[model samples]
Target: MTARSGWVKIVGLGPGADSLVTLEAQAVLAEATDVVGYIPYVARVADRPGLTKHASDNRVEIARSQHALSMAAEGKRVAVVSSGDPGVFAMASAVFEALEAGPDAWKDLHIEVIPGITASLAAAARAGAPLGHDFCTINLSDNLKPWSLIEKRLRLAVEADFAMAFYNPRSKSRPEGFARVLDLLRETCEPDRLMIFARAVSAPDETLSVVPLSDATPEMADMRTMVIVGSSLTRRIAGTSHVYTPRFVAE
Candidate 1:
């Protein structure tokens, strides 16, 4: 795409750290005429002379994506922003969903995905590789999907012994879902199974706690937290906060 071409760049800002913003994503933001995303995510982009910010509330992904695509079609260089990697439970999928259902001309537009660090990876790094072995990532919020599906996946992940990472584990409106998750784990996993709660990772106020499955509570997590549950092989270094799953699983 040329400098003046109308385009939409879906960019990931990484998890709460300016330093973690990828250089390519930063460059795209610098050239974007309009930046659109959820309220807090859009606020991450600093004010500039020729840039406009469009911030919307949560659960409006499709509408926000359509607005971005429409702006791009109107010759605006739009950046659709997300907190973590755009493809990881973020805005990239929403953009594609809009593109598929909208006008055919939108499919011809120059759309690019600019990836950044996802929260699961950021949290795993802070806790010393709780995701080192086979792993699965799940968005625990049932806003888009049913809680039954989440429960099914949780059970299968436990049965398969995959290290699991959870996003949006608990929120104000529907706090009970995560409690149900804990109950399911109690039925499926051992009491001493390792669980890591990494909150606000890479930010100044970040806190990480490594606990056992028996000790984990629903209240320990919120929208900003990334929770990781280790596989059967995952372990903590004695007397240290570091946790890791062995890469090699014995037959």
Candidate 2:
């Protein structure tokens, strides 16, 4: 497809608040004829004028991707919106899956993925630089994957001594997941390993705190929270709310 022709743009809307969107993402949205995403995610960009909105439930990935592709195939610029960096367990994957299945009509449609700030980055910034060194991110949700598999990754991360960031840490019905993660980490990391909890980062009710590993109880976190567990190299500076890990190795 020519640059002037209609194309599918999978844009990451970032985590919470409109201001968090990148300028390039905003330009894509402003030019698109259609926007598709989860209900809450679509709502974040609802006020944009002259755009057709298609909102779906959190579970309907295939349907959403097909709809966006169909629109793009019909010569309309379409943007598939995903919250918190589309590449990080967001809508971008589904978009490619739908395309890979060869929807037939969308074969020649040009697709572009515009990156945005993920929740982990937003949370890390709010709590200080816990991600300064090599780190790993894992989602604690067991809806799609087995808890055993999640536990295995946690163990690997801990043993590798990489600072860790956890997404979907806790929810109403799954309160034990985060605690279980902590228990697993305790086997490899000290109880005093630095931990940072950031809730609703960049939103109106944003909250951030830095504490030790043993102190990060389930009550201190929720689904909106992103937990950053530091490695042995992480430390706190005087009179600052951030915790940082050294990126350079000592000679």
Candidate 3:
């Protein structure tokens, strides 16, 4: 796509720290005349000097997108920040949705997405290579999706023997959701399935642990946690912190 003059770059700030942001994403943030995002995401880049910031609540996605587009329309280099990879359940979708819903003038604004390490990838690496092979990611949040649909995807991932990474596993009001997901997985997966739980990945209070699928409980997971369920092939090497997915020819 041709880069438009007054463009908006939707940048991912990575999981939790400023050091985790990609070089390209950081450059965009530094050059941006305006930065718009959710309050926490905006705070991630708070140290940057002289950048106009627009912070909004989590529920105001459309308004955030519109503001970015409006700023770009006025010839500002805008960066809409998202925590983690923008293309993965972040602000990229909202930015495009706004473009499609707004005036054609908004279409002329150059839209670019700068990638960053998603929480799933960060958590997986920290907990060991639980996603070293083919894997699937699902969000357990039922706010934007139906519970039946989430259930179906969980079953599909289990039956396919894909390592699974779950985001937004549980929240205050949705306390029972992660436990129910575990119950469904237990029905289809072996008791020995390796699972890793990572909380506050890449942050000061980060915690990681590996356990068997049958042993994981809702108490072990929260909204800040990323759950990685290993496939049948996943194994941990003794005396090492690494868990690997084998990729060798069978004898």
Candidate 4:
């Protein structure tokens, strides 16, 4: 399966599990002459003939995107792999950013972005649909934004009483920022608000924990975790701790 030369495919590999990857992404990988992505994601691709893998460290998205574009310019079929949906905190935007900011020649390259199963959706599926109702997705990493702005959004979300899915809850250098989020939730939400800590969803090392905001701790989450906070209408079933927000509100 040979992809046509001189194109770039920004593709998602899903959260984990080869079966979770979309057939379209798989087709592109089969035809790719070069694959570029973060180390873990590139590793997901099977080793095969005629496929050159280029893995890089995290936080170098722009550099990685530019490298893929350069390869495409040289008439290489390049696929940039991203875990989960490429458009959701992944490589799609980075590739486009590089194309827009790079030399004018890049605009002529054929670029396609393929989506995949994102972490939040996977986590919610595992946790019995805590996000079944109105919700918002927030990337808690302040790497690209200010902490003050994040805090403002946090308060506003709580004020609106919307269920929330948070990505990149805790990074090595920014562990304290998540702690601050917990504090804000404590101050703004009820003590019994349900919070779900879902880590590495669909992977072998996956873990899911549901607890009240009173018992929820920062240590439960890490960079790979997605935190889902239930809204005011969220509740635990009578016989168990399974939490969910109702699809319809009662008067």
Candidate 5:
């Protein structure tokens, strides 16, 4: 494709920190003629001459993806922004889904994914490596998937002894689901299993707390929080808030 031809770059803004934004994502933003994403994510991009920002509400991923693709097809350099890594529960998949179902010529457009740090990794770093060992990441929200699947995965992850990171743990519409998750963990794991609630990680108002599974409450987590449930081996330092899981599991 020629330089004047349209292209789409799915960009990750990282977890609430400008410094965490990857150089490649930044370069794409600088060159992009249009930015598209959720309201907050699109707002994260600084305004510049000749750049237009399109923001949409939640649950509109497909529509948003289609809009970006349409603009790209019209020869606009579009950047679709996501808060964390674009591939991790974000816009990259949505954009591809749109492209697949759209006109076949859309597939010929230049598209690239620019990666960035995800909430799980950022939260793990702030909490001293709780994800050091084998772990699985799951989105607790039932918006797109059934709650049964979420519960099933949680049970299996517990049985397999893998540390788990949960995204979209709780929200206003589904406040009760996280409590159910807590109960499920209580049934399947030890009371003292460490649970880390890393809220608004890397931002000015960031708060990180490590508590035992018995003491964890759903209220500690909100839409902005990243909840990490430790494996049996996960532990906190004797007198500090730091938590970690040993890299090697004993035979």
Candidate 6:
């Protein structure tokens, strides 16, 4: 008989609603011998008789991923949960980072990445599908990359007239970066360009507002907020929150 070996399953818990968690993800969560993730994400999983939850602080993604990898290597079914889709600016990449740096034997381990509703998509739906045509997503956090690089990408995305969604747009420590981003947007786009700030989507405090670029303020967004800068063709339905980009490409 083949020896029982451990495995890792990366999962996204969705935004904030329990119903948002997929049935497949829930099954993996139920069968998990060890649940590992950041404190808030781990808290979402209910206490169960056979499951052990391991919660750690934010910003220590590599170490946390290694912990989950180690647990799974010991024959435990481990689920590393992230708030949104793991592959989208979350723990999935961190796990792969750890795996690549670990021994070749680790490569033989079974690993599965289960997708879930990401914040950007949820926020986009709350608004009117500004991403209706072509779009790109950016992670504005300078933690992993430099600010100059982010600005360059932002400028290029605008130059190409792509509808854009941003993750980690701002935090308490990096407040000024987002302000600079706004300045960049104002440089290449008109004052009336549509911008949407969707905060805490699906949660009780959820607030989504569509405004013109001139009216956008730095304080309007935070780490929990998803910012979408509309293309030249994006517009709103006069008096409603509805905003969308036309399907036809513009010259």
1-251, model 2: which lDDT tens digit per residue?
Answer: 44338788999998897888999999999998889999988888756677888889987997899888887887889999998899998888898899989657677888999999999999888777889999999989897799999999988888888998988899888989888887887777888899888898888999988888877777888988888889888999878665899888676
Model 1 RMSD in Å is: 1.6
Candidate 1 is scored at a TM of 0.97
At residue 182, give the lDDT of candidate 6: 95
Global lDDT scores for all candidate models: 0.94, 0.87, 0.87, 0.91, 0.94, 0.92
lDDT of 1 by residue, 123-238 (tens): 99999988998899999989989888999999999999999999999999998998999999999999999999999999999999999999999999999999999999999999
Find the 10 residues in a row with the least total lDDT in model 4.
1-10
Report the C-alpha lDDT of model 3 over 95-160, residue by residue, as the tens digit: 999999999988777899999999999988886777878899998999899999999999988888
lDDT of 1 at 11: 98
Q: Estimate each model's TM-score.
A: 0.97, 0.92, 0.93, 0.96, 0.97, 0.97
- Give the C-alpha miss distance for residue 130 in model 2, angstroms: 0.9
Clashing pairs for predicted structure model 6, backbone only:
6-75
For every candidate in turn, the CA RMSD to the true structure comes to 1.6, 2.2, 2.6, 1.9, 1.4, 1.4
lDDT of 6 by residue, 135-242 (tens): 999999999999999999999999888999999999998999999999999999999999999999998899998889999999999999999999999999888878
TM-score of 4: 0.96
Name the weakest run of 10 consecutive residues (lDDT summed) in model 2: 1-10
